[model samples]
Target: MTLLELLDYASVFVFALTGALVASRAQLDIVGFAFVAALTATGGGTVRDVILDRNPVFWVAEPGFIAVAVAASAVVFFSAHLLESRLRVLTWLDALALAVAVPAGTGVAMTLGHGAAVVLLMGVATGCLGGLMRDVVCNEVPLVLKQGELYVTAAFAGAAAALVAAQVMPQGAALLVCAAVTLVLRAGSLLFGWQLPVYRSRPPRR
Candidate 1:
């Protein structure tokens, strides 16, 4: 299997796990777990494929992706109760998924011979949109907008790093750089309280 496909599988499994953990927090039924899992696993890739005009969406072309999502959901459904803090686990898993998905999208765009701008955009979209969908559906605040905790910023920087790395390294090595950069930035935010400054409006002067 190609590196891109392997990246997709890794991201799908991790993202689906986060989605099922969210379902557990919501006290959703088993069917709801599956629904959220598939949604979170495929949402970003589906958008990327549609925008890129790929002939078949990734999960549609290979239904094994959905099988992976289902398996993740089933496992989490039964095991989520054992976690003392599902939210914490979900956030870390989401970070890992983001790292994998960003490079997957960047690699796909690079393989298609798109310019740097498209590659960067695809990377951010693929890394952020799935978790955004999962959080919104679960009525949780989307992590991408969670007080500037470096989610989209990490994706952008990672993709940009990959683009730069491609000049001096093989494609696989470039993607590894992408994943490493993404994970480091995200993990810093989660572990060290790293944050981008938020704008605060001044009170109206009379």
Candidate 2:
């Protein structure tokens, strides 16, 4: 498989794991786990592909993507109970997914000859949208909407890095750098409790 394709599959597995973890936390059944897992695995890439006018969404073009997601759901379904902290696993898995998905999206956009702006946006969408959908479906606060979270910012930084790196390096190297930047920023936030500053509203006039 091509590096980009490999990254896509890896992201699918990681995102599906996070989705299954959410289902586990919600006490959902096996079907719920599979549904959410599949949605989270492919939602972002589907959105990106649609926007880019790429006929036959990535998962549709390669049914193996769906198979991988289903397999991930099954693995989590049978193994989640052994985890001492599902939340922690979900957080890390989400971070890893973001790292992989950002580069995957950026690489596709570049390959399609899109401008840097579109490339960056596609990267961010592919990294964030799936998790957002998962959280909304699970009735949890979506990480992107949470105050002070660096999720989207990290995605932006990674996408920008990939765009810049692609100008001077091979696509594979650029993708690696993108993933590394995203993973470091996200993991650092999780480890150090780093967050953006929240806006303060002025008092209402009397």
Query: What C-alpha lDDT, on a 0 to 100 scale, does residue 51 get in candidate 2?
Result: 97
> What clash count goes with each model?
0, 0
List where candidate 2 sits over 4 angstroms from the true fold.
Answer: 203-206
- Candidate 2 per-residue C-alpha lDDT over 44-78 given as tens digits, one digit per residue, 9 for 90 to 100: 99999999999889998999998999899999999
Tens digits of per-residue lDDT for model 1, 66-153: 9999999999999988988988999999999999999999999999999999999999999999999998988998988888698999
RMSD, one per candidate, in order: 2.0, 2.3
> What RMSD value applies to candidate 1?
2.0
For residue 180, give model 1's deviation from the true position in Å.
0.3
Which portions of model 1 miss their true places by more than 4 Å? Answer: 203-206
Which candidate number maximizes lDDT?
Answer: 1
